[model samples]
Target chain A: MTAAELLSLTATISLVILGIAMLIAIIRVVIGPTLSDRILALDLLTVIAMGFVAAIAIRTGLMLYLDIAISLALLGFLATVALARYMLSRIKDEDDQP
Target chain B: MTALLATVLGCILLLLGSCFALLGAVGVLRLPDLYTRMHAASKAGAVGGGMILVAVALVSFDASIALRAVIGAAFLLLTTPVSAHLLARVSHRGGYHTQTTMFIDELAAASPSKGTLEQ
Candidate 1:
């Protein structure tokens, strides 16, 4: 097979796998017992989304999509950090109540 | 020849990356506690996403694309750990610890007051 054909096939398969991973992360978020579990699952979901963007960049020959992936990573990190801090403050308040 | 080789390598990396991502997701879904779930998801997910980005760099064969791809991957690698640590620390302070899974409490031992607060 030609190189282009091989790359296309690989990207297709990768997209399928990433989609499955995304589904699993969603399941975790849905059933997670605690706030922390849901937040962790959400973080994984964003990372998998980045993989999706990368795979699309490979398939479509659009290098610009890599920029989207980078920006998404930055945003995801900021969101996770903010949520964690929120949880910390909430817990500290509960601790102080007693 | 170089193009073919690069494509082959990128294909391999793509497959490896997707598998790692799937593993992380499954771990997050199946792990018993928040800490173990974060342990599996954060490291594996970051590596998986980074590998896919690197695969993009390998196949593109252009300096600019390679630079952007590498930058994205590096950004992912650097940020994932920080977020994971923050989440873990918050959960620990919130008393999400599972007695069966955790054997020691080093952070708690270091600060007796914090340990008391955990309980």
Candidate 2:
């Protein structure tokens, strides 16, 4: 096969693998028993999504996907922090009761 | 040619990195406790994400994309640990005491009065 074909094939396989990772992360988000578990799952989900963005960038030879991936990363971090804060405050409220 | 070699190597690394990420998700599902799960998530997520980013950087052969990947990786590394710590601290404070396996409870010792109030 030609080099371009090889690159395309390789990129396709990697994207499929990343899809599997995303599925696993989604499963965790669905089944996690605790709030923290769900938050952790969300964190993984974003990272896997970023992987997909990277794969697309490589496959299509586009640079814009990289920007999208970075933005997703930032948003994911904010989500995690917000969840953590919420969990903390909820726990604190529970502690305050007699 | 060098390009073909790089593509092959990049694909292999991407697969490996995705495997690590998959394992991290599995770890999240299987770990017995919050701390252990966080450990798996942070370590695997950071490293796995980094590897995949590197693979993309290499495959694309673009300096700009590579720089963005590096920045994203850095952001993940910086944030994962802090979030994990916050969660752990909140869990501890919430009186979700570690099960019997916990040998030391520094937070408990540090705030004996609060412990009494909760009891």
Candidate 3:
């Protein structure tokens, strides 16, 4: 069909799909078997959120919220690294105990 | 002509990226263990997110949008793999394991005392 129709349709479908994905990741995070599993699910949630932000930016034609996506990308990475370091410190503590 | 072409391509790519993201979420839910699920979530999820950024670049009417989208996608590409690597290493260090590992634990085998690696 027309360009406007195609763009809007794509935006709707992608938003819906990423929404579902984010829900699934939340479920996993809630019942994940381990701390690491929960952390990974959180990471997935961030990725899905990025896609969601991108979809919104396109749908609204604002082009500004895409900046949010960039910030999320960096913030999510920092969070993951911080979590990993926390786990490492925990491990070292356990090692020192006995 | 070129505008229509780009719009069509952007739509297709956006759809594909969302599908990949959904697949990654399903994998995170269905996979038995942390490692395998991380494999799905980190790799496919990152690529899927990157594709969406590219689609945004393509669909947007302004060149500035494309520039921001590209920067965001590149940042995503750079950070995701590094974070995944750190997570996997931390999992190994923290004694996390997967049941369906049909392969050897080469990291442990190669380095018996994994403590020094992190130190």
What does candidate 2's lDDT look like per residue over B48-114, in tens digits?
8778777777777777777877777788788878877887776666555644257677877886322
Question: Could you list the CA RMSD of all candidates, in the order they appear?
Answer: 2.4, 3.2, 3.0
Cα-based lDDT at residue B57, candidate 2: 72
Q: What's each prediction's TM-score?
A: 0.93, 0.86, 0.93
Query: Candidate 3, residue A2: CA error in Å?
Result: 2.8
Candidate 1 ranges beyond 4 A from true positions: B98-100, B112-119
Clashing pairs in 3: none
Candidate 1's docking class is medium
What TM-score does chain A of model 1 get? Answer: 0.95
Tens digits of per-residue lDDT for model 1, B10-41: 99999999999999999998888888888899
Which scores higher on DockQ, 1 or 3?
A: 1
Worst lDDT 10-window in candidate 3 chain B: B110-119
**What local lDDT score does residue A19 receive in model 2, on the 0 to 100 scale?**
86
Model 1, position A2: C-alpha lDDT score: 86
Per-residue lDDT of model 3, residues B1-119, tens digit only: 88888888888889999999999999999998878898899888988999999999998868978988988888888888888889888888765643336477877766443343221
